[model samples]
Target chain A: MEGSQYRGYGMILLGAVVSITIIRLAYVLYWIGRPLRPMPKHLSTLIVLGSGGHTAEMLRLVNVLQKDRFVPRFYIAAGTDNMSLQKARVLEDSLLENKGIGNKDIEKLAYFEQIYRSREVGQSYITSIYTTILAIVHALWLMLKFRPEVIICNGPGTCIPICLVAFILKVIGVRWSSIFYIESIARVRRLSLSGLLLYKLHLADQFYVQWPQLQRKYPRAHYVGCVM
Target chain B: MEMSGRHQSPKTENQMVFVTVGSTFFDALVKSVDSQQVKDELRKRGYTNLLIQMGRGFSIPSKSSGEDGSLAVDYFTFSPSIADYMRSASLIISHAGSGSIFETLRLGKPLIVVANEDLMDNHQIELAEVLADKKHLFCATPQTLHQTIRTMDLGSLLPYPPGEALPIAKLMNRSQNRARSSRSLLSPPRHFCSNNSPFFFVDVGFTVQQGRTGDSFLGISFSGCVLLLHTARPRLWILLLHLFQYISS
Candidate 1:
């Protein structure tokens, strides 16, 4: 009787383990295909601006967005990029002027932050690993504090850490930081390094490409037709 | 009367030719455009001014200003308003950066894009080639820039349509409509906090400095792991309990 009872307990344990595994898999699948939940009246947006062409392209996209909807915009740039932040400020000023928003409302509506670059232009790979981790930690801090609903970025090294943290938030059921990745117009034939990482890893919810060749090459990416 | 009027006019027009390498150094582009052959080509095309915005490049053109027979040449390290120069110029020769190329294109100025071969991955060339194929601009390497300048016909170029972001905006609106519920893990603590901005008080400097110490680094990582575990417990337990009931049944 004791032996049979032990066998019964063991069978129950095995069944429990198997069922848990199957259920967990099913939950994940459901999460992936989960229907859109109703959003708040206004979304908190985080815009990651890169240097030069990346900034120009991203700002052009930002310029077209309805300001009233994506309120309390948070702009993040690489710490070393002096010009990009200045450019963003210019854009913000223009936006403020166009809308005739008062100076007192600036702090509430728009905030600017900078995150350290994971790797500089010439940094070696060994050192880059350490810096990249630091960047992720920094990005995590920012994401937690801001808790933005939307994260938009074009191809930039800085975007990698920020987007990675946002992806983690989604997976761990922390926040639904919907990531929008727009490939640069300069990339006609192939995706840039950042674009390739986000595309292959499925980090971005909506990946847009300007050139059809790139879209054909990466079937999952949407062809948006020359957004610059 | 047209031939006599042309003869009566000054030999050189007040037209300017702007050459830029964008934000980074492109010594080859600056050096190539500085050559007497290229200057003579520009002067022959009725351009009397050649302005070069050579960014971080050590190569300054041999001619500083206009000499007796040569066009007026000027050089600057960088400029705040490059568009101003593009607006005034009859012709523009710029590095194959999408910013400068599109800026020039949007202004309806003729452009010759010189692709920097040294850039790794060299995606700039593809944009240049595509634009050239569309007859929107001319494309050339540093070696062929002089030839491109000599042969490029400004009239043959077509104007690029004004860029539109309406489609992207629409897609983004749709995505926002489909966003997940706000009661996720991070939302509760934010609501609990008194201040509008919760979790804003962090000593980033001290935390970053702790990375150098082996013990502290481990401690931080451990704490981070623990935090993740604590927060994810609710969802984890619910799923496990549901599965356990299903299995027994």
Candidate 2:
């Protein structure tokens, strides 16, 4: 009688694990299998900016975007980085001027948010584990708050947590954000750490490489011919 | 200020060579450019003025004119309007940061990008080499910079192709409209949400118009076209269903 009871308990536990795995797999397939369709007139976009070079490259990309279509833009940067946010504002002000609009109305069409940095340059790996959690929590809060329809980012360590949160939201059916990751032009022969993770984990919807050799190494990434 | 004291009055026809290491300290590049050999090469190339943005480097060269006072030497740690300096330059020798490289290239200035070898990641060298191979800019290391300056033909470098973002924008738009699922029966739905709604609306409508809930939502043009309405809240779904039925009847 004791043996029979133990077997029954084990079977129930096994069954529970199997069913949960199947459901999770279904959700993954459901989201990943989505087909392309016609875009709407306007989309809420999230642009993740980083310090120095990353911000410069991203702004160059933003400069060429269709202004009217990608409205209500949100620019996310690391909390420690003031320069990127300042640069973004300058770009926004210039964009407003081009549209013949006043600077006072800049907040209505564009929003800026700062997320905690997961790890600082040259930070020890052990301590970074703790900071990484903090960054993820902050990212989750921002993701839930905005739930943007489109997300575009270049190679930035700060972008990793936000993109991860976006993927989690998709899994839970909270929001389906299309993630676009453009490898930094500085990364000619190999992808950066952030780019490698997103590519390996399939977090980015579309991965673009500026160099053709990098595309050959990572077949999944699209070679867009030096998007600088 | 010393910055103003070191400067001499500029001649309209004077050609200036701008050396920048951006926001980082690159003592090697600064020292190389400050060396006598490099100064003589610039003079040979007909450059009359040398302006160096040294960043945080330790090797600050003393401000002194050349033997003939034909070549003026000036150095500053940082500048807010570096682009103005770049614009007036006849030649630019910049560090291999994409920001500095592209900025100089777009200005159509003759550039020689020097890669910092001390940095752990040497990937920046690849960018410099590729651009050099295309004849867009000359590439050199700190040790070889003088050689590059002496031998590089500014006229041989071609203009970098202007960057285009339209392809990425088109890709983003196409990705935004992707269908919700693989099932043919479950076709793509038009998303409807506004600041007022706590949750986004993924309504399966052949033609979707907003209801009374949010001003940003589509106004009701045809009531019967919405086949399904999916929302994060069940209460909102029932309310929307009732409103749709009320409009149709």
Candidate 3:
């Protein structure tokens, strides 16, 4: 009788473990394969602005966004890149002026956040590893505070960490934020390093390529036709 | 017309050649540009001024001031507004960085991109190859830089068409509508935090020190009422249990 009771207990424990494992797997699959809902109107959006070309491309995209729909917009750039910050501010001022909005309202509309510079495209491996780790930690903090509903980025090394954080938040059942990855127009023949990562990991909700050839190569990627 | 013609004279005009190595130290690029052969070639072409924005690279042109009015080379460690220099430049030679390439293209200036082979992953070579294939710019190595510069057909190169700025608002609306109607099941989650009350916050600090080593440090801190909530009330435990159940389900 005692042996039978022990076996029964073992079976119960085994069943519990199996069920838990299945549940976790199912949760992951649901997140990975769920239907995309329409982006809610009046989104608190976060835009990651990389240095130089990345910044210019992002600014061009931002200039066309319905500013009223993306209320309280937040911009993230490298801490060392004063030029990018200045450019963002200048763009904002010009945008406001075009809308007939005064300078006094600028403070109320947008906020610029700075994170540590990630490894540049041609930087050494060891140094890049260290900087990438730092960027991930900083990106996590930004995500937690900003609580952005929609995050958009073009192909830049800096976007990788932030996208990873968004992916993590989704896995842990904190749903609400979506990442949109747009490959740069310069990437005509192949996807950039960051673009490849987001694609392989299934981190981005919607992935776009500027060229039609790329879209044909990666059937999953949408061809948005050069949004530089 | 006479005044304009005099102003445009090759001897009186200073044709600026801007050499930029971007933020990283590219000693090879600096060395190639400062070579005796390249200098002689520049003088032959009537290029009077060479303005170099040498980043962390230590090499300075040996003949800084042109002897017998050959070529006057001026270099600075770095510049905040290299655009000003680019605007005045008749030709640009730079390390194969995307930023430098894009900026030069935007200004419709003739350019030669020198690949830094020592860089990790051979990215510069790849970019240079693409740009060269497009006929947007010339690609050169340190050994071939002089020859490439001498033989480059600037008139035959294609002008890069500037991309039109996208109208994001209209695109966003169209995308949203498409997403809503589509049966595709791969959308990102919409919310992460369930509680309306602010329970967590994060602080970040970063510093970048400029030098050959280029040391950078990042600090992050997480603080808020979440920890206090765990201890403050017995009812919180039940709520937490329910929340976990909700998430798992």
Candidate 4:
């Protein structure tokens, strides 16, 4: 009787393991041949801005995006980052002027909607844990409120929480926002920590690398030539 | 006092050399530049201004009392817009931080990258070597910095093409088309949680079961969920895991 009880426990555990494996495999296979969709006519975009270089690279990419199409651009940056906010404001004004949308009409055009500040990566593991939780709460609230159709970011520590929030939203069927991750140009050989996470988790619907070699290294990642 | 020195001299077109150590203090890089030897070298090269952004916990370069004080060396703890200084400068000398390197490259400025070998990982060294190999930027050590800067021909440095949209746009277009068709076939119910509260949990569980196929899936989901929950209450689970491991041990 004792031996049979042990065996029963083992079988249940085995069954649980097997079931989970099958489910994951099915999901992967289903996504493997998924068809592409055309760029939506109007997209509420959430651009996760990193401090310094990440912000600069994302801004450069944002410059090329059809401004009129990606309306009501929302920016997320680390709480401490004033530079990115300043830069985004400057970019917004210039973008508006370039689109021939005057100061008065800026309310109607593709304007910088709002800037949300998430927790920056902390130095210590314990502090980082606390900050990360705060960041996620902030991110979840933003994701729900913004209800963005598309999300775009270059790899930054702060992007992780926001991306994870998006992933959860997708998983829970809250929203079907497409995540587009553009790996930083500097990451010629390998993906940054955030990039690696998004790639591994299948969080990014579209993952792009700046270098051809990186594309070869990670077959899933598309080699998009020099998006700065 | 230094403000007066800079403004007073409008006649001389001071070839500015911006030496930035980024947010981290690199005493080695700072000390190398602060040396009398480097000072003389810059003077010889006709670089009149040396703006050093010494970030955190580094000794300031001692002011030199030389015959020709034309090399107006200025120090700042930090700047919100280092790019402004970078753009105006003739040449940029920076630590091998990706931020500094790319910003310089983006601005189309000739850059000399000094890798901090003392970093825990040699990733910066690797990055510097790769970038140097591509001729996108010049790499140098403290020993070789003076020589690298002296020999650097700005004209010969490879121009970093401003970011192009075609490659990314094409991939995005392809991915979008694929996503659209996939959505049509396998669209999740619009309100899975709203209509069925208790069933939503069961459905999520079922979704996990359906997706899993091998032993790896269990491991992956276990770790992945922990990672996902890491943003929520990582410390609690971590402590519990530690206790479990301790008791088992």
Best by DockQ: 2
DockQ of each: 0.32, 0.35, 0.23, 0.24
Best-to-worst order by DockQ is 2, 1, 4, 3
Each candidate: chain B TM-score: 0.67, 0.70, 0.67, 0.65
Instruction: Report the lDDT tens digits of candidate 3 across residue range A65-146.
Output: 7788887788988787788878988988888888898889988788888887778656799998899889899998998888
**Local lDDT at B77 for model 1:** 89
lDDT of each: 0.77, 0.78, 0.71, 0.69
Q: Residue A7 of candidate 2: its Cα lDDT?
A: 100
Give the alpha carbon lDDT tens digit for every residue of B15-109 in model 3.
Answer: 88999999778889888888888988777666888988888887776647775787888888888889999989888998887678878988888
| Worst ten in a row by lDDT for model 4 chain A | A113-122
TM-score of 1: 0.79
lDDT of 4 by residue, B42-87 (tens): 7766677788888994578765433376577778889888879998
List the pairs of residues colliding in candidate 1: none
Residue-by-residue lDDT tens digits, candidate 2, A23-97: 654645445524333456777889999888889888888887877888889999999889898999899998898
Best of the candidates, lDDT: 2
lDDT of 2 by residue, B1-249 (tens): 121211223444687999999888899999999898888888876778899999998999768775575578999999999999999988899999988999998998889999999998678888889889999999998898889888877667788897776676666556665654433333323333222245333222332334467422322211112233433454555467556544443
> Of models 1 and 3, which has the larger lDDT?
1
Q: For model 1, how does the per-residue alpha-carbon lDDT over B1-249 read when each residue is reduced to its tens digit?
A: 022232123544577889999988999999999888888888777788899999999988866567686789988988898889988887899999999999989988888999999987688899999999999999999898878877877767888887677788888787667756632422222101211223322211101112233322211111012111222234444455445434433
> Under CAPRI classification, how is model 1 graded?
acceptable
User: Candidate 4 DockQ category?
Assistant: acceptable
